[model samples]
Target chain A: MKFPFLKEAITSLTKKPSTELYPLVKKEAPEGYRGRIKFHADKCINCGMCIRVCAPDAITRTIEKTEEGDKITFQFYLGQCTFCQMCADFCAKKAIELTKDYSMVGTDEEDFMVRGTFIKKLPPKPPVPPAGAAPAAAKAPAAAPAATEKPAEKAEDKKEEK
Target chain B: MFKKLIEKGIEKSPWLLHINTGSCNGCDIELVSVITPRYDAERMGFKLAGTPRHADIVVVSGPITSQSKERLVRTLAQVPDPKVVVSIGSCPRSCNVFHGSYSVEGPLDRYCDVDVSIAGCPPKPEAIIDGLAKAVEILKTKRRGK
Candidate 1:
């Protein structure tokens, strides 16, 4: 209502903004800021606690046994993620962690969702013995017992023949 | 005659005083955001007052820790009579994750009276404004016919 107040307001409006532009310009988040969890596939032990603690049932784990060992893959649905960062905190091996990249916008709901967020590396298994070794294992005991019985049986047969 | 005059004063202007007991700064930041360019809480005839003496509403954030109890008690005492207190987050409500800590000294009511509670880890900004509006309504009803 006052001329002085109006003049000050106009002058303030003409000045450059003091605050940084956000969302469009993209500000840097603080280090270790809890945003979304990224999985380190090779390091995961496949303990499955991350799946258990998820309040929304957003994670699913699939396990398969191979000649090598066990293989595990986990799928995470981002649409249901609450961004609570509880999953990363509870991970025992520190294989899962939250990163500060909050700019997750997508048109397709499926594309935005991250199913199979974790994969695990398995230890190499020992090789099976050759076929020849299996025959030796089966033949040794039978041959030893037969050798002892054959001499006794031959003596008995010789007496009867006499 | 004096009662009518006091009632009129409570309706036209309601000032708020904010106290932080101990929070992750999420609720604190959101509370400030309510006053910024987007929400601009002042348009609703609500204003942030510097001292408790000038306030009708007290907005509290965080779980009450041992370190914060004394300060909160002193501040609440300073606010004038016919006041309303609003607990702002899940921390003060159930203490959330910090519920069973050795140093936590609150459920808030142990120290002072609370009229309304807005429950969220850090409640959304729109919900915070809604809570404030509700508090003002309660203040109006309490003032009438007194």
Candidate 2:
């Protein structure tokens, strides 16, 4: 009962290594651990909430007009991020998420950037007769019946077409 | 063969010199934790050196404040050639939340080229170890250049 060394030795023998075998035997990050950022472009409404809440101003949004609509790109610069989780929390659509993967070692500046692109389609413009097309004398009489019957439906059909 | 063996040995054991340039001490704690038994970065032949002259890798933490800029430059100059500068945490890389502060001069890139930048407010212990491992590889190349 007085042999303290004997008891310590037995406990040490039975117990596994205190060290985490990282790089070989990987370990998982605990719950709510804020590490790398994940941006879901689809879910993002481009509200700019994440950018506003970010203390370090690590979040950036760039918009480009495309045939579809607006191509929005969000670049989360991890190098400038504080990992305070404010960006994820303030995101109204929950577009921003903090993943558990903490290994962010990089040889280049671009490696730490988390980028996502989403194209928001613009609503089709309503068709309007051009004033320049003043063939009214000849065209008016021919189109009078059809235009009067269902002009609204024809505009709706044009809106849906690719 | 002897030269190759020596290089291999040097590659295996890398002594790091930690420099604190007005850090919030968050990154510093995580860095110290890497050497503890739980993370045990020493098993990978990594160690914290007492002086910059003795270190193979320089681990810098915090944004370089205007006051500490000169000291940082002087300390870095003391480190011998073929040394790898590994910037740890977001503070050193981009000053994190401290960016644009009156006292904070800028990030580590202003002084010297950073070989490895581990980005986090205060990166996890494992991330620091991984960054150091990568620094060792970079050190190998620098050694060859020398």
Candidate 3:
């Protein structure tokens, strides 16, 4: 008896169907799946690293000078995003996160944007020095924060030399 | 009564016509895999039609390039009225990483209004199916002229 394909015939009968039936049974994206970008505005430091690293230019940041401070808003245009995760990697504050939500169907362009607004407090200005006193000017730089003291003196020195 | 039956059939089974402008083949491959036996999209009544004339929904993938601009327009014109245009990935929606390239002439909206856009470099198969299902719903509305 030549049963050329006998080994496969019985094996197929007991196996379950391979079709997923997605509409009826929902599936979950696995861990480390990069789907949608989630921005944590509070954690952001306004460094603009994410913007610099984005290959698609899908990220935009708007800085508005307000009485409160610099009102910085980041807009992630998901429609153009490549999900490359470069923006997330470059974010120093860990503000950018790509979630597992893959359902991205939408009719309007606005529906595809992710926006985050944060206010960065502007650094206080150093006190103005009197034009006549170079000695007072030396003390004036001390009024500013230690981080800005050296740069402030150097800037004033250039102005004086001019 | 016959019209009702036809509507039911249309709802159950929407034929899709896929056109690739200048994609990197990532989204196209996923779209094709949707029909494979493992996914078995046909079980849900979705079939990939051979031509635009027979299609109820058009699935467009890739960025619209200078070469494909006229062809895409012509293809869209060939699709019968009440057809739904589903942009399959980020490239067609906004040219993705290929934005501002010399050969790239578009984001899909530069030609015609995209009815549905699935966002991803190449969207997952499940997401593509989800977008297509939504497109079928929108097609029904467009057919009624609303």
TM-score between candidate 1 and the true structure? 0.50
Best candidate per TM-score, number?
Answer: 3
lDDT of all the models against the reference?
Answer: 0.71, 0.89, 0.89
lDDT string, candidate 3, B1-146, tens digits: 99989977887798989999999999999998999987788987889999889898899999999998889999999988878889998998888888889999888888888999999878899998888888988987876664
Candidate 3 overall Cα lDDT vs. reference?
Answer: 0.89
Error of 1 at B141 (Å): 1.8
Q: Any idea what lDDT model 2 has?
A: 0.89
Interface RMSD of 1: 10.9
The model with the greater DockQ, 2 or 3, is 3
Off by over 4 Å in 3: A1-5, A126-162
Predicted structure with the largest DockQ when compared to the true one:
3
- As a TM-score, model 2 comes out at 0.84
How many steric clashes between backbone atoms does each model show?
Answer: 3, 0, 0
Candidate 3 share of real interface contacts: 0.82
Cα error, candidate 1, residue B33 (Å):
1.1
Query: Against the true structure, candidate 1 has what lDDT?
Result: 0.71
